[model samples]
Target: MAHVTFKENRITLIGNEVKTGNKAPDFTLLANDLSEVTLADTTGKVRIISVVPSIDTGVCDAQTRRFNEEAAKLENVDVLTVSADLPFAQSRWCAAAGLENIKTLSDHRDFSFAQNYGVGIEELRLLARSVFVLDSKDNVTYVEYVSEATNHPNYDAAIEAAKAAN
Candidate 1:
């Protein structure tokens, strides 16, 4: 498990941490439209899964927006922001922020994505900050479990990994 801290205090992450070269775990999350979205649905494209506690927060907002912009330029890459926020809230935030390139998915219903990816923060019922890149064949090409929950991740490294996978 990844040792995680939120606001400087330690928190327990629910699942085993995934690493590069591992088979990416499959999960069912809710899309903005409330439809079930599975990893299998994204089979043929390189995926960048951005995990955050909540989309309404400063760091999460900025992170999603940054990926949205990057997604516009990455060929054959799908950037998906996963959070514990409700699907309605996720949709609202994306609309208000004018973010279209990156698809925001909600793990609020079952915490499946959070638990499977080992990013769920048990103390807060939110996801720990992390980033994952998966190639077309669903192998994890890169993984970043950000040490601090409130801090930003290594955006450049994640992007580079996605580009390489694509």
Candidate 2:
């Protein structure tokens, strides 16, 4: 397992750490409308799964917005931002941020997405900052488990991986 920290304090992560060659794990998450969304629903498109501790936080917001900007240029790619924030809050944040290119998903229901993706922080019940890029065939082509919860991810590398997956 990879070592993760929040505010420089170590935290234990649940589940197996995902790797680049592993098949993407399927999990259920809530859409902004409280509808159930599963990985299979987006089977045919390359996907960038942005895992954040909270959408309202500074690093999380910037991360999502960065992906939102890139989503426009990446054809057939779905940029999904997953967080444990409530669906209502996620919806409001999306509206306030004018984010339309990316989908904001809530994992508050069971934290299943966090656990399945190995980004779950046991101490805070939040996901660690990370990014995963999946090919159209559902293979994980790139994954970055950010060592610190409050930091940013490698946006350039993630974008390059998404483009290469195409």
Candidate 3:
């Protein structure tokens, strides 16, 4: 279990902690393109799983754009922005932002992805803001569950970790 604070109140997450060097949990999520994408689909590529509470927020939007720009320069690396938003909404945001490199995925259909990755916000109908980096073989290289849900993640460190893993 992990404790996360949102709006100055601490909330406990009732799930397992995914640590570095551990095999990443596999999940099926709906891509903005309306296609099913799984962890297996990203095999042989370094992955950045960007879990956000909602893409409507400023922090989440900024993070997605940042990753999209960074992804353009990286080879064999995929940046996946995951949220509970619907596929249509995610597609609309990416389209408006002109985001082509970063893939936006939705977990609205079910909480399988969030639950398996231990990122679900138990009290709220959203996923806890977090980031996870995985190697080509699906080994977790770095994982960060932002203690403060409203704050943006350490993108520099997460990007550096992903590059190092590659």
Candidate 4:
């Protein structure tokens, strides 16, 4: 498991840590509309999976918005923001932010995506901040597990990996 801290306090992560070169795990997350979305649903495109604790929070909001803006210029890339926020809240945030290019999915249903991707924070019941980039074939090309939950990830590195993935 990756070392994680929430607000400078150590926390426990409750799943397997993902590493580059490994096949990205498939997960079932709830879309803003309540429909189920899986990794298989987006197969042939470079995927930028942005994991956040909550979309309504400061850091998470900025992270998602940054990806939403970046998504506009990336061709053949799908940017999905995964959070434990309820689908209703996710929809509200996206709409209010005018985030059209990125899709915000909710993992509040089961934390399936969180557990599978090793971002689940057992103590807080929220996902640890992280970013993952996967190729069209579902192979992970970049993985960032932010050391502090409140900090932003290495956006440039993740974006560059997505751009380079075929």
Candidate 5:
């Protein structure tokens, strides 16, 4: 199990842990269109999974916007922002934020995605903040498990790694 602490003290997350070089666990997440999207659907394309606690928060919103902007310039790459929020809410947020490039996925129906990714917070209704970049073959190339939930990830480095993998 993976253990992550929020704000280095606020909350603790315990769940399965994913690592670089490992085959990424496949999951079925709900798309904004209410369609089921699995990792298989993204095969043959570079993918960036931005796992956030919630899109309603400042950090999550910022990350989504940043990725949405950056993703527009990337070819053959699909950026997915995942959270436990409902698909309806996610769709509303995306429209309101003008997040057109990045795809927002929801894990509210079940914890299958969270469990498979090992990002589920055991004691709370939250997911550990993380970023995973996968190659076309579904092999993890870069992974960052934020030690402190409140802090943003190293996006520049993660994006660079994703580009390099492509």
Candidate 6:
């Protein structure tokens, strides 16, 4: 298990830590339409998986919007924003934010992504702020587990990784 901070306090993360060069793990999560979506669903495309605690928060919102904008510029790439928010709430957030390119996925059904990716927060039951870039073949190329849950991720590095992966 790894550890992070929320507002400067320690928080333990539950699950296996993902590292670059590892084969990405597949997870079943709910799409905004309440449909089951898995990592295999987006095969043949470089993936940028943006994980956050909640979409309603400011940092999470900005992170998602940043990826949404970047996803439009990248070719042969798919950006998936995974959060613990419900499907309906995820849909509402995407709609309200006018995000069309990035897919909002809900891990509320099961914390499979959380535990598998090692981003789950044991204290709050939320995902730590992190971003992962996977190549078309499902190999992790880049990973950023934000040291602080409230801080932003390295968007430049993540985008560059996605570009390089493709």
lDDT (tens digit, per residue) of candidate 1 on 46-69: 999999899999999999989999
Clashes counted in candidate 6 amount to 0
User: What lDDT does model 6 reach?
Assistant: 0.93
**TM-scores across all candidates?**
0.98, 0.98, 0.95, 0.98, 0.94, 0.98
Off by over 4 Å in 3: none
RMSD of 4: 0.7
lDDT digits (tens) for residues 11-69 of candidate 2 = 99997789999999989999998999998988899999999999999999999999999
Lowest lDDT 10-residue stretch of candidate 3: 7-16
Cα RMSD for candidate 3? 1.2
Residue pairs clashing, model 1: none
Provide the global lDDT of candidate 2 against the true structure. 0.93
Which residue pairs come into collision in candidate 3?
Answer: none
Model 1: how far residue 156 lies from native, Å: 0.4
Q: Which ten residues in a row have the lowest lDDT in candidate 4?
A: 106-115
- Between candidates 4 and 6, name the one with more favorable TM-score: 4
**Shift of residue 137 alpha carbon in model 3, Å:** 0.3
Query: Which run of 10 residues does model 5 get worst, by summed lDDT?
Result: 7-16
